[model samples]
Target: MTSEKLDRRKKYTRMVLKDSLLKLLKQKTFSSITVKEICELADINRSTFYAHYQDPFQLLETIEDEIIADMRKYLHTYNLQEKEDALRMTEKLIQYFSAKHEELQILLNKSGELSFERKVRHVAEQFMMNKMTSEEKNTHLPEYVSKFIISGSIEVLKIGYLRDVRNHQKKWRS
Candidate 1:
């Protein structure tokens, strides 16, 4: 096959594997998922699965890393200093999750391996730390303020996106 066709085929195969893993994650924890199961669900052999990823955790990490990278690009591409920046960021998040709703919902469902949720929390914390006033070193106002607002905003986005996905699924079912 041509190089273009081969690359397309590889991409398609990776999507299938990731989708299969996501589907499995919805039913059970990441730790419970096996390479065999993923391969079976993906309709590929163990070797094929191994070729792309060493194990389930590796696959999950790969997917989460890609998602987190995309998220950072989306959220940090513009500075969030004003109220409208928050609004724009929220809308962008909604759009991002909506486009990959099902896949995101599953991978983000409390993966037992690595906590992307905690990663997001750390990111928010770092952003808050950067925004802290240098003169108010003793106040710690940034920590307090960001803990309440940014963390809450992240939670709201997660809950809202998941709820919207569930509602969409329901709409499709009925």
Candidate 2:
């Protein structure tokens, strides 16, 4: 029971810290963010922050790692060879993006780091390569093709999301 309680407390501390960092990312780039600011925003002590992360950059990297891991899990759930499965996977991916919209927006747009975006593309590319049919793998073209498609799709999602956010803001202000 004591161990469980400690686990819960640790989870809560990490949650608040993640939230605080993301909230700060909205106002400034990750490079400009400080450990002190994150702790103050989280209402957590700087020592506690250091206990969990080396710095704000590490915390951000942790967040990115979690996102990529989740994406990998999602990608692995479907056999992408079948048309129906592929369609279902795409739908699920969009749903995942919708669920993570705010966090993604901050990371993809606000963080001012291409690293996260590149990591996302790399994960997707790896998933595609692993799922490709033997025949498809024989041709080197699929590798390049998959990279192009994944990168374009991610860019389109980013642009479309930003446009939707702007439209929503306009509606809210009117």
Candidate 3:
């Protein structure tokens, strides 16, 4: 096969594996999920899984890494100094979260993993810190304040997103 075809095959294999793992996470904790189960769900061989990832945990880590990278990209895309730009940046982030709701809900709430959530909070905190003026940083208060704000913002985002999803489902049912 050509290199392009080979790369496409590899990408498809990884996508299915990641999707299978996320689906399984919705049903049970990550620790209870097995490589065999992932392969079975993915309809790919165990060898294929190992070719991409060592185990389920590594697969989960890969998913989390991708999410963090995307979040960082969104954060760095805007100049946060202007209030209008800050609001637009927030809207972009919200749109991203909404688009990835299922995957994020599974990772953040159902995966029984704290590390992924912490990584998200860290990313937000770092972005906030980076946007702060030098004088603000010199106060030593901005660090603590930013941490508090970022932590609260993340918790609100998670809770609010879940609530919004549940509300939508209810409306659809009715």
Candidate 4:
């Protein structure tokens, strides 16, 4: 096969694996999932799965890393210098979540099996820390204080996300 065709096949296989994994996550914990099951779902060979990821957990972590990288790009695209910028960022985030609702549903589920919540919190923490660093304030707050505030903000987003999902379900049902 040509290099371009091989790359396309690789991309297709990886996407199938990841999408199957996310669908499985909605039904069960990641720890309970197996590489065999993932390959079965994706209709790929076990050897093919091993070529891309050591196991299911590795695939989960890879997806989380991709999410964080996309979020970082979103953060970089905005100036985020003022409160207005923050609000605008929030809107953009909500839109992003809405578009990726099913995938986010699996990732953001309050399951103890994955550290996705922490990964997202880390992104928010990093964004806040960068914002604070860019501004010249009278007095600098400790990192812990900033982290605490970011945690609170994340909680708010969680609540908003749940509410948004609920409303969407209602509209779908009706």
Q: lDDT scores for all predictions?
A: 0.66, 0.75, 0.74, 0.69
Cα lDDT tens digits, model 1, 42-106, are: 99888988888888888888888877777666666544654333334444445555665655556
- TM-scores across all candidates? 0.67, 0.76, 0.76, 0.70
Candidate 4 residue pairs in clash (backbone atoms < 3 Å): none
Question: Model 2: residues >4 Å from true position, as ranges?
Answer: 1-6, 80-88, 110-112, 160-174
- Tens-place lDDT digits, model 2, residues 1-174: 245446887999999999999999889877888889999999999999989998887898899899988888877776444543343444455555656777776788853478989888787777666766789789898788767766656765666574464446447555
Q: Residue-pair clashes per candidate, as listed?
A: 0, 0, 0, 0
Summing lDDT over every window of 10 consecutive residues in candidate 1, give the lowest-scoring window. Answer: 82-91
Model 3 weakest 10-residue run by lDDT? 83-92
Off by over 4 Å in 1: 1-6, 80-105, 111-114, 126-139, 154-174
Candidate 4, overall lDDT?
A: 0.69
Models, CA RMSD each: 6.6, 6.0, 5.6, 5.8
Cα error, candidate 1, residue 37 (Å): 1.5
3 against 4, candidate with superior TM-score: 3
| Lowest lDDT 10-residue stretch of candidate 4 | 133-142
